[model samples]
Target: MMRSNAAILVCVLAGSFVMAQEPDTKTLFKEFGRSVKSDDITLSFVLLNNRTVDVLFQAPGKYAVRARANQSTTFYVQGMPEKDMVVDTKFFVEQDGHTYEASSLNIKNFDGNTVTKGTRVDGMIQLGTKLDLTHPFTVRGSHGSVEFVLSPEALKLAEPAPAAAPPPE
Candidate 1:
């Protein structure tokens, strides 16, 4: 009985040590939405391993996502009900072995149903980088500001690789 107890304790300790060495990779998924008059606007996102990000936007029953060749992506939202609305957006991304900020995105809604947009840049900043799903950002409009964060257990989708050039004939 004593031997069995000792073995069990050792195994538990070893397992804990091994788990500590592993990277803290958390998946995230989140959604935010609101109704304006008869229109509805929503934003959803999924992030994995700080490597991949997928964002979906819905406005007045219309849904769309932003995708690109490189790590950077841009998305636009239209059909807002309030004119003279100001939209503020911010986010972060890793680039050139460093992190950079893509913030202070203020959009003026001249028309009541103007289009607003956001962007995420990940790798090479000059060319643009992927979105940093780890950090939280805010989208402020006439109604109010909606904050977005990564959800636990988010899908882990690998980024698509760039197409290779054809070999010389």
Candidate 2:
């Protein structure tokens, strides 16, 4: 039987490796980074599982909220020690003339109707399944937008190397 994901996490944390039911997910973090800027706001994305993206927004502090994406939403707000602040404005993406809104399951800093600000980024955002990384895509919000394509170097970094064979008993 397949081990539970929590069990797998614990085994990995103990410095022992647990082979996955699938070969491709052997690495801890299977993701690639892409970033862009709109005005003074910079947004970075790590496509964590092709569809799940961690969006990091950096901007001036004491900012107000705005719309960034459409559809069901979950937001995260974190305050950096460096005074950098982030607010997840509802965001939307336009690709191939169709609009796709990020669906997030994040409840980290949620406070009733607001996602309370803390010290981090949005680990939510379920990107569109049809998100094309090979081509340029744009992410837009109330302030501005950024357009970018996945870089070959960045993609290469996301490729998982095979795990080492277990040591002698």
Estimate every model's Cα lDDT from 0 to 1: 0.36, 0.44
Q: Considering only N, C-alpha and C atoms within 3 Å, which residue pairs clash in candidate 2?
A: 68-89, 68-90, 68-91, 69-90, 69-91, 78-118, 78-120, 79-118
TM-score per model over all chains? 0.30, 0.43
Top-scoring candidate (TM-score): 2
Deviation (Å) of 76 in candidate 1: 3.9
In terms of TM-score, how similar is model 2 to the real structure?
Answer: 0.43
Using lDDT, give the best candidate's number. 2
| Candidate 2 weakest ten by summed lDDT | 61-70
Report the C-alpha lDDT of model 2 over 20-80, residue by residue, as the tens digit. 3322322312234445454434445444432122123324311221123222222232221
* lDDT at position 132, candidate 2: 54
- For model 2, the local distance difference test gives 0.44
